[model samples]
Target: MSYPNPNPYGPPPGQQPGYGYPQQQPPSPYGAYPGGGMMPGAPAPYPTVMPGGVKAARVMLFVLAGLNLIGLIFAVMGLGSVSKASKNASEYTTSDAMTAMNVGKGLLIAVIVVIVLFIGAAIMLGAQFGNGGSGVRVGTIIFGVANTLVSLLSFPFGLVHTVLGILIIVFVSKDDGTAWFNRPRY
Candidate 1:
């Protein structure tokens, strides 16, 4: 038969919960204590951190720029075609082409203006990637909304731009994007 321990109320001898023995600590109320552990609602401490999905936003801007470039090219080609046709019609037919020519000129100016505005906005949006302030984010969102609405005016021709603009708005407004913009810096 084995003998009973002298102190029954506590752990026996070296088996006590201290020194070399392991002991379970109570759950911390404040969460992670130190090191690289992340606390809930705490921003990441890494310097290379960026907003989520910013790449896609930048890509959208680049796509918009490409579309604007395409529009410029198309506008140039259409202008050339219209100019040649109008000149030929005026030379071949006695009917007055002045009104038609004036209308075509007006359309050309309008197309050029729209294309320039979009191209400029696209470049600005792309340039601000990873380096812009809160103002840039707000401005981009506004630009995207305005672009989408105006693009809708172009209907079938602008459907792609409208979709891209919508995507930009969504991506920029995401939690990661906001965190990146609002993250503290040195």
Candidate 2:
């Protein structure tokens, strides 16, 4: 009779080598990515961490929201004043006074609506920075453009908004910001 193989690592005679060892898979034809499992020539994966510029943009968004809140408060106060002025104007029979009052009230209401929208957008976009996708990037750019334009109307106080909006646009439009927003979630 034949004796068993002397080497413990080797398979016994008449038995397959896989009996006690794992089988090796054939090498893939394509080269592996640096992280492995990825196909060759694919774009590099985005970074997992939030980039500095993106973080700064997010912070600026929140700040812009805060400023918008202040504007909302002022607009509301102005609306109240307009209502009072309109009431006093109603005492006069002249259509001119009434027309002016109505116009002032309408303008104040419009300003309030716009301020509310700006505040909502700033908070929503700022909060989404952690998990937001490319849409967030696009939304931010649009928001920046709008903010800059709106700030032009207010001049002195809006100067702050204009500066912040410009900075946010710059930060979010950079390469690192794009990568952060494009990064795969999960």
Candidate 3:
């Protein structure tokens, strides 16, 4: 049986609201909206994880550069000490002076070569963080792996550097880091 309408202002009995009645909320764990309550109409989220590794990679490069400098200072000091000792010993032997001087010069040259190679590498890696392309990522990975292996030869002297280099390698290869390198820059 159909029921007659009692009031004229409100909607008829058993009929849907045409204009004034508020909408009913759906059942959910979180009152109305779920998934952290995002608004009904909002723009898609932007990429955020891509820019984080950049600063970390740059800082690691700077740290490695400082280590290279410290190594250079130590190498120079040791070279000086060896040369001084050799000079004192050579005074006792008549023909040993020239030979000793030659050895000292050779040792100094070797140290200088190693220092130049490593310091140059450090500078290159450090400078790349500014506006580096994808090649920089590959370069950094190569450097980090090579550095870790080379550092092992130095043992205690390069322990810290090895650890830091490994971290650099890991960071550069991660998802976010890869994304950062692959990003399109206009």
Top candidate when judged by TM-score against the true structure = 2
lDDT for each residue of candidate 1 in 82-138, tens digit (9 for 90 to 100): 777776674556445766775886798788888888899889877887777677778
Predictions in order: lDDT: 0.78, 0.88, 0.74
Give the per-residue lDDT of model 3 (tens digit) for 4-38: 77787788777777756766665443334545654
84-167 per-residue lDDT for model 2 (tens digits):
877866454588878887898899999999989999999999999999999999999999999999999988979999999999
| Per-model TM-score versus the true fold | 0.70, 0.75, 0.63
Q: List the residue pairs that clash in candidate 3.
A: none
Model 2 deviation from the true structure expressed as Cα RMSD, one decimal place: 10.3
Model 1 clashing residue pairs (backbone): none
lDDT of 1 at 74: 88
RMSD of candidate 1 to the truth, in angstroms, is 8.6
Residue 90, model 1: Cα distance from true site in angstroms: 2.7
Weakest 10 consecutive residues, lDDT, candidate 1? 43-52
The predictions' CA RMSDs to the true structure, in order, are 8.6, 10.3, 10.5
Which segments of candidate 1 are over 4 A away from where they belong? 1-47, 91-97
Q: Best lDDT goes to which candidate?
A: 2
* Stretches of candidate 2 exceeding 4 Å from the true structure: 1-45, 90-93
